[model samples]
Target: MPVPDPEVRVTAVDPHVSLRTQEGARATPPRLRDVVMAYVGLTKPRIIELLLLTTVPVMFLAQRGVPPLGLVVATVVGGTLSAGSANALNCVYDADIDERMRRTRRRALPRHLVSQRAALVFGLMLGVVSTVMLGLLVNWLSAGLALAANVFYVVGYTMILKRRTTQNIVWGGAAGCFPALIGWTAVTGELAWAPVVLFLVVFFWTPPHFWALAIRYREDYAAAEVPMLPVVAGARTVARQITGYSYVMVATSLLLWPVAGTGWFYPTVAVVLGAAFLVESHLLLRRAAVSDDVVDLKPMRLFHWSNMYLSLLFVGVALDPLLTR
Candidate 1:
């Protein structure tokens, strides 16, 4: 008070100025809508949608017609939560690599919109809630299967296999196959050969389906140091592998018809769809063989078609029972 220090000199605050505003600028709290959307983005909703497509159709197949609306709803809800948990945990674990990849750089964690600790807690919460909800509303078997899938995806795939092996998605993909079993058990309370066949269908389908996307992002994967097939193998080699797996996937799909005792309609659809899938895969192989260029490879064509292939194939599964009935 005796003398003002030159370094510490300050101007008097205006009486009209609010004390909060006078305390230096504070960051605007994130908008509520933005916060909600960020959390939803963390769950990777589109992947969950694809997983549910596999799930509900199997429930319909298991019931051999329309399942109870309540049971269907509960199973779907639990499955979504479980898948979300797995995906969120995956995003958290992969955040470091994600920031390095152009395709994944925009995700919440990489963008700094959400903290890793918060995401981890959210993922674990979803897993617990899904398990409890399924056990209470559906059946314990389904709940157990969902929990197993979550563990396999988070621990088996994300942590253990993703970065270390080119064959990572091949075996780790079994996590996705669990939905077929979960859907079947939700209705029948036991596993069967039919769902097992469908499980194999998805298991074989995984490599080709994911490798196509990897073809498009080979550089991103190389930059991230991941050993995806495309990152380590020549385009022709990856394409050949894709075509081979496509053959196995189609063959496995047909097994479901005989194993589940489905009628003419299901097999007919399976044949048509399988033929189309084979054609597309072979086209991808031909393209890769002829050209090393990603643009010429046109990998996304197969990527997009694979999504439709699985969705429509499962659609066939759902409609088979109702149509045959």
Candidate 2:
């Protein structure tokens, strides 16, 4: 049985007096709290934090472990705001699919915490403000790269590739990789191979990191028709891909020493840490071989550790110059 729609009733208390009433009238109107949470969801603070973590280290390495304080701060702030804006725009584009996924159902647009129009407006405003701040406070090169990254993520990746193919993250990873180059350019006012190496590191690292996550939430992705690597390629394929990329990441980390000119601490740490990363990747590969497997929690653990790995690895770069000297 279906529930009835609200019924309107009118009654006359007296010959000339009339009263009208409606059921289900405004049960708890929208509140300021909901609006604020929507803004937070728009920003994607966790993603911004991770992106800026990659950004700031490039600044330090660009200036040889000593970037100008103002430039560093500006780069981080502008990068964070710009990345946040890009994420919000992505939310706007993916709202329909997000509503279908349990993981994303509570998001601002999906939950009606914020309207699509409001999100678009806020995203664009943040982007413009961030671009201006970066140009005025940082450098034109950094600003340009930041703008490009935002455009790539919102338009090229989120709007198009995401729905079209599983390689979305492979190409889209380029957007996040830009922060490393942007950070380097912020301090040096030019490009070089060092940041490029860092960019490659993150670019290759992205697939495994995201695939691991997608593996954990496979059903959600399947339900949403997201076309993630795990959905298109299958778990076994994704695991092998993770292992292969882990090897590439390790090999690339070793090259940073000569290319980026870091101290002994880096290679020593790189060899040890890189080996551990490989071990984790192999574990994921082994676990993914089973048929009808739902999710690999262990690989998810590795995915989390992989994030910590990159952060600590970059920190090694900053500390190497001091520790070795």
Candidate 3:
């Protein structure tokens, strides 16, 4: 009682603190449901579904309006799986940046809902399963393309280009283009310029499409040090860049008729849709240069419309052979 030694007291407390830390470390692991959700979130399943929508119709065209149902199923499953893999990998790679961006701050990684190692392993497993499924069930060509897309998205876009330039989405978008190609190949067991044209359409569309999101989230992107067009270039310059890409996208969509051998129906819808796209581009450009009016709602409007544009454009492709002269 006269002297409970300070050193002995301190040593006793140290063991308790260490035990507490160990228990916390063990207890902090995520629940199984959270881990499952993290896996789902990585795939960006909704986006993959939309992208795969283009695949079925392209397969129909590749097979001259009747694709094997079995092949179609294989292609869709493989494409969706591979896409989810890429998305998951991106989430894992960008976890730190995701934390800094307000829009992405609540993502699985930033929330500590999933660990990085888990995400990476899950992504790689999805890719391998998808690629193998496509190769054995669909065709080697389709599987090869899927593998290439996964590699490009993970190694090329997420790891390299996303941090390097405003054109990241422009080039990185190639990964998304493979679904059209995969669908076509799954049916025909061969590649053609038609899918390539379809690929270019999505490729060119990505810049303008993504730039709208960038405009809305400019501050977040800048804070996170992501080199999105709006962050790397001033708003005005980014606006001009978006307009230019929109023009290219519109024109590329029209080429589907000539290059992919579609009828006038595709070109006609493309014309009207293309003009609408151009109008949106002009609005984004004008607002960025001359006004700060959220009245422009142009970016948001265009962002929504771009999705419709691609959907309808693909629908037009699907309907062309049946409806056209």
Candidate 4:
């Protein structure tokens, strides 16, 4: 008889689970619900949804309508796996800071729902599987982009820049922008200006979206000693940067109309959504300027609106091709 992999087997009682609580401690058998959710938590599934939103719409625009079913399925699955791997690795790496931050204190690692070693191995497995799936089912270009995104998120953002820079999310957010490029390349098997422009839109949008959250959790980041912009800088400074990035983000979205020769839907959505984004960003800035009211900045108002803006913009991206065709 073949021997099972020792690392993946906990005890003879359960051959499937190797998860342990801590060093030298006996791991009580995890409840079914807890075990399921713990692994699901590793993927950060909500973030994968946000990442996929940018992906599918671009595939529609790239193909000028719905792409092949096989292609769409392959790309989406590959992207999800790749992103999950990156997020899981981030959770493992940031376990310490995560324990200190209010928003992250309940995460799996901080709560000891899973061992750090298990999380590390899970992340590596997903990363490897995702790369192979994309390479085999889609094309190597899409596969390569997916692999690059995972590496950038794990190494560039989580391991390196996250703790060291106030500009962490600004640059590190590039990892999230790869979905657009991946979506485009998945169909056409080549890079082009349209996807590159859409990639920039997401890249610019990330800072403001993230900074609003940073502003809301400035205290948490400070407590954890992570130098997010709002944690290290004055509220006014952070708000100004958010406003600046919002301008570029909106402008980049508008450029997509011209660059892709997209129809009225995209341009109209761009104008309307861009205006709302500016108003909210300016409102946050005004709130920040009130010295006593900085604590009540309510940056989440803009944060939530930014989410809507991206969703609507991408919806228009998908619709433009169908309507124009």
RMSD of each: 12.6, 10.8, 12.0, 8.1
Task: Give per-residue lDDT, candidate 3, residue 268.
Answer: 90
Full candidate order by lDDT, most accurate first: 1, 4, 2, 3
Q: Whole-model lDDT, candidate 4?
A: 0.83
- Give the 10-residue window scoring lowest on summed lDDT in candidate 3: 1-10
Q: Write the per-residue lDDT of candidate 4 for residues 1-325, one digit (tens) a residue.
A: 0000001111222212222322235357668898779988888887888889999999999999989999999999999999889888888898887666656665688667789999999999999999999999999999998988888888888888989998788888899889999999999999999999989998899899988877777776787788988887888988999999999999999999879999888899899999999999998889888852445898778878988999999999999999988
lDDT of 3 by residue, 209-276 (tens): 77777776666678778888767676678778878888888888877877878877778989998998
Lowest summed-lDDT stretch of 10 residues in model 1? 1-10
Candidate 1, residue 256: how far the Cα is off, in Å? 1.1
The positional error of residue 96 in candidate 1, measured at the CA in angstroms, is 0.3
Candidate 4 lands at a TM-score of: 0.91
Between prediction 1 and prediction 4, which has the larger lDDT? Answer: 1
- Extract clashing residue pairs from model 1: none
Per-model TM values vs. the true structure: 0.91, 0.89, 0.87, 0.91
Against the true structure, candidate 3 reaches a TM-score of: 0.87
Clash count per candidate: 0, 0, 0, 0
